[model samples]
Target: MDSDVDESLDIIITNVVATFRTRCHLNLRTIALKGINVIYKPEVGKVLMKIRKPNISASIWSSGKIICTGAASENDAKVGARRLARYLQKLGFKVSFSDFKVVNVLAVCSMPFAIHLIDFTKNNRSIASYEPELHPAATYRIKHLKATIQVFSTGSITITGPNVQNVAAAVETIYPLLFECKKFLGK
Candidate 1:
């Protein structure tokens, strides 16, 4: 009877040790897979913009400004910038160019999105103003445009100027293509 009891105890301990060893192997495998994924991932360094609706339109003006119109909220305007950044990156334009040239982005949510243009040239730096009358909120200068962003009841916006034009055109082309991407990603 004592021998029978000892045999049962030994079996139980062996089973427990086997189970722990299996679990430890699985944990190590998981960690290895994660490290491999990080190493193999592509280096696609581009800015991303997310939007709730695809209601915006973009155009590039002759003054080299890229304009995005139809952002209904401040969030929408931010999305516009993000989208523009990605578009510029894909076109082989340096990310720094987008950062340096796009000095300001203004969003106004009125009947039409009223986007003010201010040149970021050294001599025209004064055009970018944070005045209450010119713009209720602070404004920043991007390249050759001064931007003020506001959310209005209306959902239409027009972006104009030469510098803004190229960027706007690129955005206009990319937004539609990205429409399905948003749905597929469930974003």
Candidate 2:
């Protein structure tokens, strides 16, 4: 019975993820670039990126606020945010970034909300250590590295005290990686 229940849950989650992917496919593909980096700065709860070519830059602050510094237009900035949010979701990270708020479509379009999480495991141990409190309509768990990455689908991610700091620090440390991706995209 337990196994059956677990299997059912898996199927449900898979279906939800698939639906999200399909809905967002077009926008995601259109804005998908070859190179991009995601940096974590836990101290400030911020993630910053430096993109070349088109010279795009942006940041996700701990307060659940997203800012675009070098986008060509408001549309560009929104698209960048949506792409980042979607990619994070695909990677198994729970994201609260709102697609409707960030993405503005002139015509009728469908954008699915999705989040993915990848657990870090090695040496017979998991890395994620933080456990966040339960929130409505959000799902999360701890992975490897004492790092717990939680994402929200309602366009707002809630972070507590220490976890917020950790996220910010991680974003800063990983900024360079995002730049490398940008370079690869030739943008």
Best by TM-score: 2
lDDT of residue 76 for candidate 2? 53
Mark the 10 consecutive residues where model 2 has the least summed lDDT.
Answer: 10-19
Best by lDDT: 2
Candidate 2 has what TM-score?
0.29
Question: lDDT tens string, model 1, 38-104?
Answer: 2221233211122234344443321223444455433454456455445444544343323322322
Residue 19, model 2: lDDT of: 7
Per-residue lDDT tens digits for candidate 2, residues 1-187, read 2242222110010000000111222222222233256555556655665545334565555334455444443445556556655655665445655533322111111112222111211111333222335443232223322333333332223221122234334333322322222211222
TM-score of each: 0.24, 0.29
Candidate 2 positional error at 154, Å: 48
